[model samples]
Target: MQGLKAVLPLLIFVFCVRAKKMRWCTVSDPEHKKCAELAKALVAVLPPAAVAAFARLSCIRASSTTDCIEKIRANRADIVTLDAGEIYSAVKQFGLVVVAKEIYSDGGCILSVAVVRNSSVDIRSLQGHRSCHSGARWTAGWSLPLGFLLSRNYLSWSKEQLLSQDVSTFFSGSCIPGAAAMAPALCTLCQGQKSYIRQKNYHCETSHSEPFYNSQGALRCLRSGTGDVAFVDHLALESIEGSDRDQFRLLCTDGTQAPISHYRTCNLGRGPGAGMVTRANFRKTARKFLTTAQTLFGPRGRERQRFQLFNSSSFGENDLLFKDVTDKLFVLPDDMDVSQVLGLDYVALLKGLGHEGSSLEDSVVRWCCISYAEQKKCEQWALSIKSDPLVCVRAVSMRECIEKIKRDEVDAVSLDATHTFIAGRCGLVPVVTEYYEKERKCVPAEGSTHLETDVLPSVVAVAVAKRSSRSIFIGNLGGRRSCHGHMYSPAGWLLPYRHTLSLEHNSSSPCDPDQVYNSVFWKGCLPGSQGNLCKVCMGGTGEAATKRCADNHNERYYGNMGALRCLVGDPSGKSFGDVAFLEQHNLQANILSLSSTGWADGWTASEFELLCGDGRRAPLSEWESCNLGIVPPNTVMTRPVLTARVYDFLMKSQETLAANPNTEFKLFESQQYGESDLLFKDATQCFVHTSHMTARSILGGEFYSHIESVFNCTHSDILEFCNQDICSIFE
Candidate 1:
């Protein structure tokens, strides 16, 4: 009896663990009935040991897919199947994760194709013809076909205008269900409520009330000669009853026609089919339940005569719990997020179609500015640009600017090396890069452009010091005062500080570069820093003394010119910095302008010297050989969807405004705004459209590898979060 008691607790715990229950959320009565039938049938066929691997199946009824999403979010249910479009919303808006995807015989994706009865119609000539679509915003039906047309320039659409308007115009009359309110003519051919066609509410609904509301329904529209062409999944053609299938053909983008069986080569883009979503934490549970369910009621199920997992014909409907065409449920990897499953290009297409928000505006490119002075300069530049109106949007910091661009609040911004890395990690791409070679007209060349061939125009990062600071060498500068442009600026902090960290140091905290800098330097001015790092910072002169340690232009020592001011000493001549880490682009110009602008009494270009990595100091003019590293030029960045448009607008602005010296408003010049580089670097000679290059490619392999090493060890919260987010999705 005592031995039995010892193992009794273990036996009970194992029994409880094996008795887990899974609640499958269903959208309709048919799905609920089919789910219940499968739930009962699985229990009778699977042995106790086999059933222990999965949860006891149960059904939870919901009114619609949106309701199902909410139930699953609230944890009232465990798993649910959704359309590809609904899956996007479930994952993005509801924080749900995709566990598995329904796959047909071909694969996990479905081929979107345009079907027609007549073979003479070319793909480009579909305009002004009646069209049939599966449904509004559906992947195979509407989004894919429309995205293909818009991306290929077969249909014209402006970001400022509604896509429905362009689509309504593209087709003279159509059977586009669920879009009656957006465009009524799109439902002209839709057979609404077969027996009650006069009811406008049922005319173009997404439900059975509208005859031409789904893939099968859309094919019926094409067969009845109600529409000239039908855009639907390739599987929908298989539903054609016998001889009626011979009347349909597929439309190819290359202006040719192919038989329905040749849809693999003649179709719109292949998009992810229906996906199964659950709460992120419940993914394992959902996966196990799906795997076990597939084993029992699947095609070769032991209880196939009782219930079918993928079929719902017994329930008096098609595609009840899952798509009838689904051959199997392919479990996705844990790392595959909604974006990965749908693909970045497809997500970009959805965003361009204004699914979540409008990422691009044809009327204007909202330029993101970091500071008040930068915003003022951007506003001024906006006024001067003639093509593609420019609008200025303000953010508090560079990271915030990147976040705004990611959220589609702002269109584009110019980012330096360090922030550009973070932006790329956050999924933004470079549209244009600052060119420093020389001024040239924006004309087509026979050979590849500099950017196309990956010949980046780089600026030299130099460690500058006053000629009098003789003891401050690159190797032995501990306990000496330092100057930096700002906290995260490439030349001011990232490059130079990282290079300094590469040298030997005995500090306990070696992971955090900021802490190491603060510990090594006695007192220095590094704007946007705190405590000792901001000790040498001279805030605004008069009433702005309280603005010390600020991260913007309000601080006197905040940029390349500001770093030079720190090395030149304060106006009271009380505190002088030992070294100034800056770039070589405007070094001579800023040094010469100091004396003329009255910021310094007797400043000369010869008063400064560059410290080389070999422990020897060279004159400022020899920075090409004595610098720390060659930093890539600032890049204009935006969401992937807006890369082409932003690049075009910038190219236009350069040709019409900055290309000519006679124009009063210069796109690159920023001295008038009381800052050195406001919207763009003042030394920028031209803009290189980097349509083919990513932020990593623009930084080049050597520089990218160097920065990656530095970033891997540094303790930057934003960069860490961005990297972690990226790795969780992509890696």
Candidate 2:
């Protein structure tokens, strides 16, 4: 037994040595044959020292590129070459690593282009034209051309049907490989293998069995009068020899044509070329193998008489193991990943083409609504706009909406100044500020003088009280009942008690804002508050009464309008709330609306008076001077990546609404829903793109300082959660 144990370690080492084989995956039978030839050629040419560093070479056949990706991920295969689009899937979905990329004579990128026999047909009006594509889902042939056409509104599609079906209908006929089952009409012009007895059934396949399978075959399809146009990359145009190549013209997006060589000016888009990928840890081994292959059979190699790495014409195929146009194999940086290899623009192009798997959501701007009333208004507004699709997503509170934006469950939400600050901290950026002024944009012009009506596009926080409340002033309101919009509200909660609590000065008590409000007020209606803080809060009416003291519109005392209703002594004759703290932007309109809506039977703007911070009383019109602070206006907030799209959608929707006045729904007006300021402030007139303005910059220095005074005292749940390490990635 001791003698056998000594040989056990040696046996295991021998077994491991025998198991070390590097397998190259191929998608087609022709590709498999070419790979086997290349493997044999490498062994015959490599020196002993160089060959010792690599394992024995072998070939594995896969049904398709996707199958190859799966095999490599499962350790059944070790290396493979794929185009940029398939490389995106291999890395993003299967966690494969790109080790090297093909560099052409021009660059390491391919320009997608459309080729035609003549310049007779306009590119934009190809509704009934016959088309030829290299292969279904290929970058240049399908994704870039279709995506560019869709973006330019040259073709129409809906999420309900497959994009393949739409393309089949758009074209009279086509020869798109790998689309035999998805859209059979797309393969009507495809000529399958009819001469070979073993592969006669091959029809619309992504292999060389189908005569019109790849870019070279697609070019033949166009040249044979079987297809009107061929969609391919610049490499295909450059590879074709003879005077027939001059017969093809490049189709530009501007309804013009150029020579086939003018792809730089008349192309769809540029994308990365095919690349070699393997497991991350196996990158070095894969790199060594490819380096030896390139040195042996590359364009400048001495072994070109026996084998050629880039050319597959000897195997009766094109681009078998590597692209035929590959000039050399370039090793990527060790730290470079797929995104870096594809470039940001190419990655975004793939994402826009639905390669990221959320194309429907990417097409529309989903507005986040916080209440039933706001959702209803948003729905109406969505139905009214047609320039850009609008969808509504519901959340229970403003903070929930911001969280939803961060999680990508929703797109954008209109947030007040305080909530905007919190949303900014969570990686949501301001797209556009709600414009209230009539004449100018939010940011003043460079040389233009400030007009008399220029107010910097903001709302003023005002402390309002009934004229009959003679004893209730700002300084002597310790034991009085107060009406607040909601917990953590800027005007209702923060500004109202900014001076009284003096939380910034206190350090021993943990500076809890909730405890401060609970201690000062006797009993009041502060929505989202529990215990005595919500004692006077009137819940929703009818079926919604179960939502009493809720944080949303279900609570009767929830927002600016709700706070005003609370101070008006509630329609139920409950005289609990005394002083109302809210924004002064929609104050007069909300009060005037109360008389017609019957929420308050006799409430008028004249019945309320503004209370200054210095214990002086003034009329409601003097809010500009007697206000606590000038808070930034509500701004549309969305994810940083979505800021530009959201802004474009909003601007287009606003322009549509302005051009058609008779439209049933309004963007800024929400009083028609029996509530004031549902999705946005009722006083807003337009929208101003904030450009690169953040919440802090938009709020200016003074108001941001006041905001600091409020939140610096206490840490809320939002701050605690968003301040974690995970949130830093989004920021």
TM-score per model over all chains = 0.66, 0.56
* True lDDT of residue 697, candidate 1: 84
Please give the CA lDDT of all the candidate structures: 0.76, 0.76
Candidate 1 residue-wise lDDT at 121? 79
- Per-residue lDDT for 301 in model 1? 52
lDDT tens per residue, model 2, 1-731? 35435533543443244335688998677888998888777666554433443337889977656667888999999999887777887888788999988888877888889999967977888889999998877878887788667655567666467778889999999999877767889999999854343234556776666778778889989989999999987898867778877888989988899988788989986667778889887787687667757765889755777799999998878888888988889877788756567764456556655566766677788889877788888998888877568889988888888877766678789888888888877756777787787665433367732111224477888999999888878766766788889877888877766655332333244345566667677788888778988988888876344466787787878888889888886777675588888889889988988788887788778888999988788999898889887777888887654665676688778778888998878877878877777888887877766735667887777877777776777767876655543101111
Model 1 has a clash total of 0
Q: Candidate 2: where are CA atoms >4 Å away?
A: 1-68, 74-358, 439-455, 501-512, 543-546, 727-731
